[model samples]
Target: MKSKERAIVSLLCATTICVSWRGFRSCSPPQDQRPCACERCLSKDDPCFMKRFNKSVEPFLSANYNLSEDDFNWWKRLQHEKGNFRTFRATVARLFLVIPLSPDVLEPSPDRCRTCAVVGNSVNLRRSHYGPLIDFHDIIIRMNAGVIKGFEADVGTRTTHRVMYPESSVDLDNTTHLVLAPFKILDLEWLTKALTTGFKGRSYAPVMVLNPAFIRYVHHTWLENKGTYPSTGFLALILALHMCDEVSVFGYGADSDGNWSHYWEKIRNKKFKTGGHPGNTEYKLIQELDQQQKLKFYTGF
Candidate 1:
């Protein structure tokens, strides 16, 4: 064979070895053998895994910090609401005085895989018997009037985090964390007044307000700005994805009878539909995530 031809063949072999070595290094597992739900798709080059997950978005608001004009304006437009910026700043200042300014953010760890169960208020949870399964998770996140007294067999009794807004707020114990999803500035004022003076009842739970920027991220990136805004349950599910290494969703879609009422409430409206939110699109996205094995989704019977 000619010397030039030999040189070209050697170069091709060297290039193949280099590419193979790089792929091996990238796919190598960590030293810790413990299983992680995110490791599979993340390491296997799943196209949709990291497409919508924005790590730079902060999940909670802190004290002594001011939101940018763009963030404030975008957040206030959720409900077509209006409020004075000065008043909103003052309310946050007062709120920080009473409770903690900055709560500890949950970061992903190599040694431990944090599991979270995001429980919704869908009517499908009526007889699921998922109470034990839900309680087994490291973090049990319940949202929006998730009652546990009578339906403890289905919805579970333990709650590590409770997501709520001013209108859908419920009394919480000291152990559970109150995650407030404020859409308008008045919601912030309501949280301050509720904690300082008391709203419907007293609550000693630690408070964490969802960041407006994070909400915008979910709407534009995840939902592609499909609806007016994402619902509270959807927001809580996304928040769990950020906070936990593994996530299991429960009681999300409609029941077998196609009713859209809450688990605790009777079927008053058969044709009840979500207001201003793209409920169907969000559910389809969730189904896709489940299909891709990104998160475990439980469609309760």
Candidate 2:
């Protein structure tokens, strides 16, 4: 071969070896020997937050309320930790059955754009006339004790999902999903009991519990554990990001007069602001997210 041709061929061979070596490293398996092709699948410049998030919280998804020593130890650790959780271990253990793990209820689909509306109970919703608009979404998620009965004109009556703990448990219709945000083992127990046998002389329709990992994600990563944990509405918005292609948040924060009251309730004083929750911080965060075009944040009408 001519010297020039030999040089060109040698350069091409070296280039191929370098490319192949990098590809192999990028496709290396993770700790579980499962393919960890994230580096190859996602561009480094592209912000793949969701992909990173799912990987980070995989363990929390596997947690179950089984009545075993390990399960009891897990609950014990959570109880000792500084957070908002009501202890109902004794009551829950009395049920004498390993609570089966709930399936992932909010999996994403590839073909459709899942629109979601996270409706908070703030009084700002009153006279917003967003009822019809709110109802248009594929999913309408309401927070704890968020009523739509009388004020259906302001807040839509079409509720696809309701998020609550044991204290805020409400009677859900057959169609609406009951997504439980368990703060403690008792909350999980209450959810199981509510769906199965009656708990505290009351039973609810079948319910789904949020993956503990997702909840932990919202608390540690999103809220930075700002105030014990993120509020129900805040957590709901985070959950929406995972399940929906587009997310619209409504009825969050205080109203015009700076009073934090429910749309259905009459505001007596400004003292009704969100207690134990960093409302202002959360509002600012929501606004920042809006500025980034991650989601639409409607402060009011």
TM-score of 1: 0.86
Clashes of each: 0, 0
lDDT by residue for model 1 (1-301), tens = 6999999999999999999989887666554643453455223355576788876778888985568778878987887666766766777787788778886556665666788999999988889999999999999999988899999999888999999998988888888899999998888878878887875575766789998888998999999999899999999999988888788999898777666679889888788888788988989989998898778999988
| lDDT of candidates 1 onward, in order | 0.84, 0.67
Q: Report lDDT (Cα) of residue 63, candidate 1.
A: 86
Tens digits of per-residue lDDT, candidate 2, 210-229, equal: 65556556766766667655
34 Cα displacement, candidate 2 (Å) = 23
- Using all chains and alpha carbons, the TM-scores for the candidates as numbered come to 0.86, 0.69
CA-only RMSD, every prediction: 4.5, 7.6
Residue 277, model 2: lDDT of: 76
User: Which candidate leads the pack in lDDT?
Assistant: 1
